[model samples]
Structure formats: structure tokens, C-alpha cells
Target: MRKSYLKLFGLACMLTIVSCSLDDDRVNFQYTPLQITGASLPDTFELGRVYTVDVNILRPDDCTLLDQFDVRRSFTDTTQIRTISAVGIVLDKDECAALNDSLQDAFQFEVLYTKPYIFRFYTSDDSEGEPEFLEIEVPVKE
Candidate 1:
């Protein structure tokens, strides 16, 4: 009877250790990106032209937060003479309004300029993995 009790105690202790180890291996937590908004424009933005676009971001739960996030643009026609970059610089409402006003009625812009304009969000833990990406096509006018 004593031997049987010892065996049962040993089994219980083993089970407790296994349960603790299982909990440590769990990575159920996650991160997300909330709202993402931006635009695109013609090669040369002309004053008084209307550039239209549909701006939307990935759902928050779908994306992971990171130390840095960047947007990359690549034009389909290399000969089209255009430049694209992420709108990283901070601009006040007046400046944004001015830009919109300038592009309100001068040139024709479309969202199909490139194949992949990637939005990459770099994880703070660089050692762990690469940043997540969200692709978008924004419209612009000149």
C-alpha cells in the first residue's frame, strides 16, 4: 500500500510539472494596427486638380504593432517619370488642405500606378522576426 501511494504521488508531481511547462510555451497574445490612411498623386501635382482615392487600413487584429512602420511605392512604368514615398513627414491641417486644394482640379490621377505599394510594420523585437506588411493602392492627381 505504501509503494502504491508513493507511485501515485510521483505521478501527480510529474503532471504538475508538465502543466507548468505547457503554460510557459503558450504565445496566445497578439498585437494589431488600428487606422491607416494615405493617398497617391500624379508625377507632377498641378494646382486645382482632383485626385480621388479610397483610403482604408487593415483591421487592427489582423496586423501586429512594431517599432517602426514604413510605406514603399514602386511604379509599374519606369518611363512614366514619377516619384513615390511614404508620407512620413508630419503635416498640419493647413498644409494638408493646401495640398488638397492644389490637386483639386488640374490633372488626372489613378490608383493603378504600381504593382505593390507595401506598408511594412517592423516589430520591436527584431531578433524574433521581420515586420508585417499591408498592401494598398492609393489614388493621386496633378
Candidate 2:
């Protein structure tokens, strides 16, 4: 009887383990580009100094959360240009609310090179389906 009870307990444990699932209802997060309305940058940058750049962005819905600033630097031999864009982590759930709200966000930028830096903030696509940007140049003060 004791052996039979132990066998039954082992079968129950195996059944419980088999009934558990690793799949969840939460959908996979998608990274999407957000629209940058405007940005507040300093007129000049000082070497080895950190500056806080305020950026205004627009989101499609409340389900989208700001992931980080997609700062892509140009690897060209002549130009010191960086493209500043905002990427959002989207949670595609059923209860997500749709709204178009402008949000203000800031990021820290440190000046390393002595040359002038050109920032291209992504706004949106134009009428011809071309990417538009708000370009600003900040020279390094020596």
C-alpha cells in the first residue's frame, strides 16, 4: 500500500508539471520610432562637459513607452554628425488606450570631440515620403 501511494504521488507531480505552460498572454515588445517635435540644445558645447538636452516627442498611444534615445553617430571621416531619434517600446495589448500627446523628455550628452557637432532630430516623413529632420549645429568652445 505504501508503494502504491508513492507511485500515485509521483504521477500527480508529473501531471502538475505537464499541465504548467511557459507561454504567457503578454505580447512581445516592439521597438518603434517616435516623432520628435522639438529639442532644446545649447548654443555651444564645452569639451569634457556634460549637458542635458531636452527633447519633445509625440507618441501614438499610451501603450508606447519611451525606450531610449537612438543616437546614431556618423562614422564618416570628415563630419561629426549624430542623428538623434526616439524609439519606443510598444506593448500591443487589448486594453491599450489611443491618444496623441506631446511629452517632454531629456537626455544627457557629453562633449568629447573638439569639432563642431551636428545633430539631426527626426521629425517625420515629408510629402514625398522622405525623412525630415530638425538640424542644429553646436560648436565646441575652446
Candidate 3:
């Protein structure tokens, strides 16, 4: 009877392993290759005014944060631009998570001058894939 009980236990363990692996085909969602589904900015912005802007980041699953940002300036027109480094802007991770899309993302920026600038933000997962980013134009006036 002892030998029979041991055999039953081993069979049960094997069945459990097989059953779990059988669901491997379920979705197989990956977090890489993130996309920015939305970008929001005010139609009119004034110099030295703090403003809240948002970008909707999307992933196949809900498992990442909006990581970093870059600022640039358009020289003659929107076509030609250069990256401008400055501070006073931050990523609101908590707010991003509460917004639309699988992953939430938005940035709060304080305008330093009355000039047009380009803002870029990046997002990624912990495991893999190249960084994905989005850029928005901030047109400021005096």
C-alpha cells in the first residue's frame, strides 16, 4: 500500500507540471517595443509659467514606467532642431499609472523662457528591448 501511495503522489506531481505548461500559449504578451499613444500640450503657453503636459504610453502589458526626457529647440522651423538641456521638469509616475492606456505616463514642465521648444520622453521595461520615446513641441510666447 505504501508503494502504491508513493506512485500516486509522483503521478499527481507530473500532472500538475504538465497542466501548467499547457497554458504557455496564452497571450504571450511582451513589454518591449513601447509606444506613446497620446501627447498633450496647451495651445498657448506663456514664459516662466509651470504647465502640466501628458503623454500616454502604451505597452502590451501593464509593467513599466516612463523613464526619462529631453528638451530641444527648433532653430528656423519645426524641421530643424537642437537638443537643449535644462531642469525643472519631472515625470509623474503615479499620475501616469492612473491615466488611460496600459501604462500611465505624463510630464510636468516649467517653461524657462518665451520660446518654442521640443520635449522628448522615453519609456522602457526592466528586461529588454531598445528604448521607445515620444517628442512634443512646446510653443511659448511672451
Which predicted model would earn the best TM-score?
Answer: 2
lDDT of 2 by residue, 1-142 (tens): 9999999999999999999888967577889889999999999999999999999999878899888999988835654898999999998777878788898999999999888899999998899989899999988887
lDDT of each: 0.35, 0.90, 0.54
Separate clash counts for every candidate: 12, 0, 1
The true-versus-predicted C-alpha distance at residue 46 of model 2, in Å, is 0.9
**Could you give the candidate ranking by lDDT, starting with the highest?**
2, 3, 1
Write candidate 1's Cα lDDT for 32-127 as tens digits.
332333433334433344454323332222212222233333345432222222222231222222121111112233334333223232212235
Q: For model 1, where is the 10-residue window of minimal lDDT?
A: 97-106
Model 3 TM-score, all chains together: 0.42
Write down the TM-score of every candidate: 0.21, 0.80, 0.42
Predicted candidate 3 versus true structure: per-residue lDDT over 1-142, tens digit per residue:
9999999999999999877866454433222334555567787678888887665655432334344435554565443233322122233233333333454455577777555776555544236755544556767778
Instruction: Return whichever of 1 and 3 wins on lDDT.
Output: 3
lDDT: which candidate is best? 2
| Candidate 3 or 2, higher TM-score | 2
For each candidate, C-alpha RMSD in Å?
Answer: 17.0, 2.9, 12.7
Candidate 1: which stretches are off by over 4 Å? Answer: 18-29, 36-55, 59-142
Model 3: CA > 4 A from native? 1-33, 62-101, 121-135
